[model samples]
Target chain A: QQPVQSPQAVILREGEDAVINCSSSKALYSVHWYRQKHGEAPVFLMILLKGGEQKGHEKISASFNEKKQQSSLYLTASQLSYSGTYFCGTEYLGSGANNLFFGTGTRLTVIP
Target chain B: EAGVVQSPRYKIIEKKQPVAFWCNPISGHNTLYWYRQNLGQGPELLIRYENEEAVDDSQLPKDRFSAERLKGVDSTLKIQPAELGDSAVYLCASSLVVSSYEQYFGPGTRLTVT
Candidate 1:
């Protein structure tokens, strides 16, 4: 099933911060974050594995809560380059469970 | 290393027409995936392949959509008699492995059904 994302869209001024939340009903073994600009392919940002894990790349960070089966992506000091649709994909572990399910997505627009 | 590659960046066709999209995964990647994205939505997996074997295809529209990764390097997704609703972006992704590995995506082919 597709995970749910909160604040479907948000606008941020340069230097502002924003957070996108993704929640899934099923337990997640890992969560993957990606960003996609208009008319472009999605680019992998970071991946958070199970075990109360957290990961970050530069100004982008994410935290995964195993108990809640949810994850959140944090964009700090947003820049124009950060304007895009962010998607969170969750992965589960089991026999024949190698696929990643993505969330509805949060569109972020940064203004100067 | 080069990233995943997809062909025919854009395609415009009429309903009932057939269309095909090609994808070449990153070198050394062992897993490939096909996804479809509608306007303002996240991509939904249509199928995934590990090497030459189809590991998952539960979301594929088997009736009209078929995909093949002949050599486990490059893949092809075909839609015969495409419908209006098929007018969306077809994305291809690859990873070192499908089991808990990060995925790299291609630019994708935008399909327009008139």
Candidate 2:
């Protein structure tokens, strides 16, 4: 099943910080994060496996909570180029298939 | 070290027409995926392939949508008798293996049906 993302949209000024949350009804095996700018492909940011591990990518980081079936992405000191739609792809447990079910998305706009 | 590649970055077709999109995954990648993304929504899996075999296609609309990954490298997705609601971006992605976490995506094909 697809995950649910909170704060459907967010607006931030340069150097600000933002948090996007993703929750799934079913158990998860991994949570993958990606960002897509207008007219471009979604680029991989990072992935957190089921161990409740947290990973960072530059100023962006994400945390996965296996017990709660939730993941949160942290964008600290956001930049103008960070304006885009963020999506969380969830791989459900016991699905047996290596497929990702993506959430609706969170629109983030960083202004000067 | 090229990323995934897709053809026909944009396409416009009328209802009841046929359309096809092509994809070439990064070299040595063993898993390929096809996703359909609608406006204001996240990409949804349409099909997935491991090497030359289809591993998952339950979400694919079998009545009108079909896909193939031949020779374990290139793939093609076809939609026959397209409908207006079929307008969306088709994204192709690949990973080193089925269990690989990170998937590299290609520039998607934006389909507009009139």
Candidate 3:
């Protein structure tokens, strides 16, 4: 099943921060985040696996709560380049397949 | 190293026609994935290949859609007798290993059904 992302869209200033939440009804093994601009491919941001391990690349960080089947991405001091649709992909641990179920996505716009 | 490569950045065809999209994954990447992204939505798994095998294609519409990853390096997705609802962007991605968290995506091929 696909995950559910909160705050369908968000607008922020250059120096502000934004948090995107992704929740799923099914159990999760890992969560991956990506950003996609219009007419462009989705760019990998970070990944958070089970055991509450948090990973960060640049100002973007993500935390996974395996128990809650939820993950949140934190973008601090956002920049113009951060404007894009954020997607969270979930993987089930027990499945034999390696496919990732993605969420609807959250559109983020950073103003100057 | 080059990322995934897809041909025909854009294509427009009438309904009931046939079209194909090609993808070349990064070298040495054993796992490749094909995703279809509709407007305002995230990419949905269409098929996944490990080496030269298509391990997963449950979401792919078998009646009109089929895919193959020959020789474990390149793949082709074909849609026969396309329908109006088949318009979307086809994305190709790859990772070094199976189920890798990070995936390198290509520019994607936008297909429009007339």
Which candidate has the top score in DockQ? 2
* C-alpha positional error of residue B39 in candidate 2 after TM-score superposition, expressed in Å: 0.4
Q: How high is each candidate's TM-score?
A: 0.97, 0.97, 0.97
Residue A24, model 1: Cα distance from true site in angstroms:
1.0
Better of 1 and 2 by TM-score: 2
Query: Candidate 2 chain B: worst 10 consecutive residues by lDDT?
Result: B95-104
What is the C-alpha lDDT profile of model 1 across B1-114, one tens digit per residue?
899999999999999999999999999999999999999889999999999999889899999999999988999999998999999999999999666778999999999999
B10-104 per-residue lDDT for model 3 (tens digits): 99999999999999998998999999999998999988988999888888999999999878999999999999999999999999888545889
**Residue B6 lDDT in candidate 3:** 100
Native-to-model Cα distance after best TM-score fit, residue A46 in candidate 2, in Å: 0.4
The parts of candidate 2 lying over 4 Å away from their true place are none
> After superposing the true interface residues, what Cα RMSD does each candidate give?
1.1, 1.1, 1.3
* lDDT score at residue A20, model 1, on the 0-100 scale: 96
Docking class of 3: medium
**Candidate 2 CAPRI category:** medium
